[model samples]
Structures are given as C-alpha cells and as structure tokens.
Target: MPLNPEIEACFEEMRDIRRHLHTCPEIGLETAGTAAFVKEQLDGFGIDHQDIGANSVLAIVEGRGPGKTIAFRADMDGLEITEETGLPYQSRTEGRMHACGHDGHTATMLTFARYLADHRDFDGTALLLFQSGEEGFGGAVKIIEDGLFEKYKIDLMFGLHNWPGHAENHIIVHPGAAMASEDRFDVTIRGKSGHASSPHLCVEPFAAVADFIGGAQSIITRMVSAHDKAVISITQVHGGSAYNIIPDEVVIRGNVRTTDSGVQDLIEESLGRLADGLASIYGVQTSFAYHRKHPVLTNSTPEPAMKAAARVVGEENVRTKELPAMGSEDFAFYMQHTKGCFVWVGNGMDSPVLHNSKFDFNDHGILVGASYFAELLKEVTRQP
Candidate 1:
C-alpha cells in the first residue's frame, strides 16, 4: 500500500511536532519535558497511556478483537551536541541537540499512534514506546526491569532509525545483527607520585597508559578474525594533573563494538590481559573494569517484518541485505525478550551525519516512517 492520505496530510503537523522537540532536546533519563509533551498528545487523542521508568512513556491502542500484540519504539533522548543547524526552530537548550533524528523518530511514532487510534481496522493491541536514555543511560533496561514485558504480552516489536547516507524514504532491514554490541571499560593505572627532579623515584604510570593504549588495538587486528567485524577505540584518556610532578595514577576509558558475543568476550579478556601485562612491566598497579552495556541487536526472525516494510515502500525501495553498521543501539535489550526487527529509514545523503552539531532529522521522512509503522501494525495484528 502507498502512503496513506491521512498520514500524508498530517506531515505538516508532524513536522511541527518534530521541530518543537528539536528546540528543547533533553538528554539521558532526564526527559521530563519530552515525556510531558508526548503524554499531552496522547491525552488529546484519548488513548490510554502511562509513565514507565522516570521519563519514558507507553501508550496503548486496542483493536476490535483479539490477536497478536505488537510494539513500536522511538528513542526520545538528545545528544550532548549544540545545534548548528541554524533553523528557525533551532535548539534553545545549549549543549544539547537532537542530532540523531530522535525528534523525528518520536514525531513519526506519535503520528502513527494518532492514526491507529482513529481507525480500529485490526485486531489485538498496539503499544507505542517513547524510550529515553537510548544514548547511554540504559533506559530500555530500566523499563524492562520495571516489568514492561510482564505487564503487556507483545509478540513482536519493531523500531527504526533515520539513516543519512541512503536515499530518502528507502528502508533497510537485516535478518541478523543489524547493529553491533557496545561495551565500555575504564582502566586505572596507579604509580608512586614524586617530584619532577627525581626521575627514578616515581613509577610513572604515564608510560603504562601509553603502552596499553597502543597495544589494545592488537585485540582487533591480530586476535580477532579478519573476516569478522570489530572495533576498539580509545575515546578518553586522563593522566598527569601538574606539569612538574608525576601524578600517582592515570585513567583510560573507551568502548568496544562487535557483532558476536564470543568476540565481545575475547575483546574484554584481551583488554584486561593487556592492562595487566603492561602494569607488571611498568611496575604499576592496574584496575580494569569492563561494563557490558548493550548486547548485539539481532533480528532472529525478520521475514514477516521485512515483508511489511516492502509492502509499504515497494520491493524496490526495500533493502534486505544492507551491511550492518558498527554503531550500537539499546534496542538490543528488547530483542533479548521478544523477537524483533530494527530497520533504518533513509534520511537523505545531503543531511549531516548523526551526532554532528549541525544534524537535524529530515522532515520529509516523517510520512514514510509513520505509514510504514501503520502498515506493519495491520500485518502483524491480522486475525489468523
């Protein structure tokens, strides 16, 4: 089916909603304003909804009869970037912007909810999830721990992200491993503090930090298979405070991304072993803390979901074999409990990359996304 006229007509309103969200982007689990905005809209539609976690919102739409229950999730958190888009509705909050198109995601989901509420042509229930802290705060985990799945029986769940490189309105879905797993580590190296004049008196952890940082890459290049995809990046490093005195300790922090769990385990083990070996050689005490944040987002059963997308965007516009991205998503948490698929909608190649200061969600993709969700709902909830 082509884009619904009702949804096409609502594009302007959805764009306005997206712009309003972009103006006041919130970060992490502190999305009180965003949640309130979503709740107000849901209330306007007279749809039953409730608050999950501290700032996430969940809304339900019941159909005429009993069937399978499905879910659509949209992340509501913004990045730490300051807006450089310079649009009339630019972000008012400094150092916070919806550079990842989450504003667009929320707007699309809201539009879908409005449509579903107005027309009850299907069976079962439709759950709309406005998740927060998808950036790194584990909002999905918090909501699940709060008994989200236990409260509602969802058979299948689907989520989408706006992609910058593909053509506008194009859809990409993968059967397995749509996105990589994310794991963070903090390594602290401790050594004796001494005066700058006394070179031999201090153990000097700076050397150990340098050695470990340089050697950690070997985990991916040598240890991991070349056929498999994995990445280890040292994003942060903190060491000496004063120029004259050698600090007692230095800390290194970074993240690892992989498509396989075994590779993830190998990376963590290699990191700890590298840190330990470096500390011993440099005569420093080392502490390595590995935090497994989000697992790999794999689509165990993607045929039905992919077919629904193809029906909406036409088979030519639907891509089923796109290369998986190295970026991570917390939606992996949902896939652990229920069979789900995470797809990517094109945000246009002209648009800036995600997390960039100037990036804004393409308003043109709103109708395409909302219509796709609506179509998927019809397909999944069809009476058997």
Candidate 2:
C-alpha cells in the first residue's frame, strides 16, 4: 500500500511539532510544557482532553456509535543528556534532550490526533494517552491508579516504539512475552574493620562481596535452564576508602532482567540462600534488598486490529517478530491490562540509537506511525 496524500501531509506537520519539542526538552514527571503542547494540538482538532496523573493528558475521540474502545499511548518525557546532533532544530536547553526520541513519539500521536479528529465518521471511541515519566518512576502504573481504566473504559490498548537497529521499518511483534521483567537489587556485607597488616584480624567484607558478585553470575548459569536467558549485572560496588584498612561494610548493587517469571522467582529465592551461606562462611553480616517491577508484556495474538492496519501500509513496511529485545518499556504496563500489542516503528538505519546524545527520531517514520494509528481506527471502529 502506497502512502496516501493525507498521510504524506501528516509527516510535514509532525516535523513542525518535533522541532519545537526538540528545542525544549524537559525531564521527569513534571512535563507540564510537553503535556500542554499535546493538549493544545488536540484542542486545535476540536477534540476534548482530561488531565490525569499530574502531567498526563487523556483524551477520548468519540465516534458515531458503540464498539470496542481502543487506546493509543505515547510517553512525554526527555533524558538528562544534552543534544549533540547539531541539527538546526537542536535542543536549546543545556543538559536536557529528547535523546530517547520521545519527542518523535509525541509528535506522531499529535499527528494522529489531527487525522482522527478530521475523519471521525466511525464507531467506538479512540482514547489518546499522552503519559508521563516513562523513563522511570512507573508512569503507566500511576495512570491506572489515577482511574485511567475507570474513566476511559478502554477494551484494548496499543503502544509503539521507535527501534534503531532493525531494518528501518520492520514492525516486529511477538504473540507472547515481548519484553521482560525488571528487578533491582542491593546487597550489603558487614565485617570487622581492622589493620590490613594483621592477617585474619578483619573479616573482610570486600572479599566476601567479590565472592558474592561472582556467585551471583553463576546462579543464572547453573540454576536457570540453558535455553533461557537471564542476566544479573552487579553494576555498582563501594567498599573501602584505604588500602591499609578493611572497611566495616561493603555495598553492592545491580539489576536483573529475565523473560521468564519462574527464573525471577528462583533468582530471589536463590539469592536469599546464597546470602545466608556466605555470611556464615565469612563470619560477617549480610543484608539484601530487591524490587520487582514491570511485569512482562505478553500479547495474546497479533492484535488483529493492528495487524489489519499494518497490511494497509504494505508488506515491506510491516514486520513480524523474529526475536525481541531485552530492553524494558513501561508500555508493558498498559498491555497487561488490555488486549493489544505494542509495535515498533522504524526511524531509519543511520538515525542515532535511542538514549545516545546524537540520537534523533527520524522524521521519515512520522507519517508511517500516524497512518498506522489512523488505519487501525478505521479497521477497529468500522460499521458492523
């Protein structure tokens, strides 16, 4: 399917919005400016919006008759890095940038807002979710807590991400387990601080932490199935200030990612056991803290509504999953509550990777994503 004139024009509008957002990058949950921009766009199309979760904008596009209420969400947050792309529309705010291409995501949703509002001769409601704090702090969960479902009464939800690595427009999707669960860990070991010159005088926590970090790796390799993939990365370790003396306590922190929930359970259970045995052997005290967040995103099937829309965009542009990435996304939170699959829109091969200072969202994908959103509405909200 070739691009329609309406879709082509949407890309240009997206460029205008993207450049404005790129110049002013804001961070964290307080995206007042960003949310305001989205609200303004919806208003321009004569659509109504409701504010929820501090900075989140939720709008429902009510169509002609009754049908399944589908939702489309886009995050509105930026990273802490400064822009280095040196583009004419580069970020003006120092030490702040839309390095993750959220500006692009927001722009695409706005374009959809315009197109859908203009073509509202359909059935059912289309909910627009311009959410806050996707980078962290559990934004989606908060939106749900703020009565997202109760208000919109969404039957299905959909999300899209701009992927850098795959062939520019490959729309990957997995029926189940598209992303993993994220778990963070903090481990501390306490020992007797003593002079390094005196051998065996101090129960060395530094040595004990080192042993535990290494053992943490083995837990995945030895305990989990060989076919399964799980990672335990001890990213931070702080122990001693002086080489001459052993520190009384050593702190180690890391994160865990796994596709399998059973593996995550084993990780926590095994870590508890390992801590007990290590403390007894080294004659030191051990403490552990772990947080499990963002359950896996499992799509029951290729969202028939989204897939039909993908077909309208041509086979070459739409891609099904061969394999999925390990990186987690908060969109998973919405998918868990509704029966919809998150799709990946291409930002071209040469575009900067997400979160990189040089990264910028490819404007080429703007119309493609918007068209998908529009086409999805036509399919899902059609005459009976």
Scored by TM-score, the top model is 2
Tens digit per residue, CA lDDT, model 1, 1-384: 778789998888888999999999999999999999999999998898999976999998888888888889999999998888899999998999999999999999999988988987788888999999999899999899989999988899999999999888689988899999999999999999999888599988888888898889878889999988899999999878787999998899999999988899999999999999987799999999999988999988788777787887888999888888999999999999999888999999888899999888988778888988888887777656
Per-model TM values vs. the true structure: 0.94, 0.95
Model 2 misplaced stretches (Cα beyond 4 Å): 382-384
Go through the candidates in order and give the clash count of each: 0, 0
- Compose the digit string of candidate 2's lDDT tens values, residues 211-251: 89889999988999998868888899988888798889998
| Clash pairs detected, candidate 1 | none
In Å, residue 175's CA in model 1 sits off its true spot by: 1.7
lDDT of each: 0.90, 0.81
lDDT of 2 at 196: 90
lDDT of 1 at 64: 85
